[model samples]
Target: MIDDDAVGGTRSQTDVVIGGIKQMLTSGALVPGSRLPIEKDLATQLGVSRGSLREGVRALATLGVLETRQGDGTYVTALDPGNLLSPLGFLADLQQPAHAADLLAVRRILETESVALAATRLSETELAELEAILAAVDDSLQADAEMDLESFIDADTRFHRTIARASGNPPLAAVIDTLVGRTFRARLWRAISHRGSVRETQAEHRAILDELVRRDSERARIRMAVHLLGVEEFSAAHADEDPEAS
Candidate 1:
């Protein structure tokens, strides 16, 4: 639960400015791409000192709610999900390895549904594009005795990103991308320490593509679940072995 003072109760002058701006935003008085009132005007309106209002504006700017231009005044941002939810990646990065399973579990729930949606939505051209991405993965796998880890990870990111975007939900795709990107270090460690992981991942990707090709949402969902679950289990089993986990 959030602290009572944090949500309500006695507040600081900066909080007043933040709350005032939030009220404007929620009541449709302020909108995306709209310029904010000048600092003196806004400070007077909010009944706060200019310093407090400036601090509040800085806080919102950090949260992707507003932006300041060089010559132009401050303006509301487009409020894109990718920008709004970027902090999720920061939180994910702070999780200890013990919490990796929990993080991946959430991802599994979101991405299974994402893939199911993508199955029916992906265009023929998009399907071919996904195939090409997998072919790149194959090339990375066969590149040398030591797999080209950078190339392989790049392909892995693209494969999941393509499917997530094809789900036709920008917010969902953004969340999935945040989760996937944060877990990438763990995935890299798994591939390096566990032989045959590359091959196993390759097979799983093929299975998902097959289901997508058939436009079978349920089967695609199941395949995606199994694939993510494997990662969760692997992380749980090997967390102690990962120096990065510490």
Candidate 2:
């Protein structure tokens, strides 16, 4: 039910230009991470104005179909559905409180299954990666270096992603990747609100790692669920706290 006429797609020229771009992405003429022709060149080739070309690119970028580098040219993003799942994640974050919990429930379902699978299938390399991530978590917690919200969240994400990777399915890893996009950043911000939460997360992370190292998948999965549930509990308990407070 898209009204092409409403979204800068009214003109015949605009429609043709958008159609061609869609065809290119769909037909694989433009692959992920591949740079597109320069804007002027693409505009000329598609018989559209440079402004229109930029508009199209901006739209695609918003959809995670493309990424624009400030000093460099634009390129297609990894077309993995997981890569494009951020919008849904963002929407979920803004949804009703109950809906947010629902999303978390779905995440728990996926991750619990993954941890069980990982126990049966992880390769030595994958196991080592998990250990490495755990080591990084320890280092980050112990470091005197000031970790900003972004660094903390990235490190936290790497921790979970390593576990997902150890689960031995790229698709499962991707699912967790998508699931984290919404709330992981907020969780870091929440942790920064209370000094104690940071210490708590670090201790909990070690416990989860210990469970994994013991090759007890059930314990690992349960620990992970408890860890996340603790966050949910703590966040709920401090709903009125300032997320930006140091």
User: lDDT by residue for model 2 over 110-171, one digit each (tens)?
Assistant: 78778777776777776777677667756776784444555666666777777777887777
Per-prediction TM-score to the true structure, in the order listed: 0.89, 0.58
RMSD of 1: 3.4
Candidate 2 ranges with C-alpha deviation above 4 Å: 1-79, 92-103, 140-151, 186-188, 191-195
Model 1 lDDT on a 0 to 1 scale: 0.83
- Candidate of highest lDDT: 1
Q: For residue 58, what is the lDDT in candidate 1?
A: 97
**How well is each residue in 1-246 modelled by candidate 1, as lDDT tens digits?**
122354465888778888888888999989999999999998888877899889999999998999999799999999999998888887677766667778878989999999999999999988998999998777766776456655666777889899999999999999999866836554545534445577788889999999999999999999999998998787777665653533
Candidate 1's displacement at residue 190, Å, is 4.5
Clashing pairs in 2: none
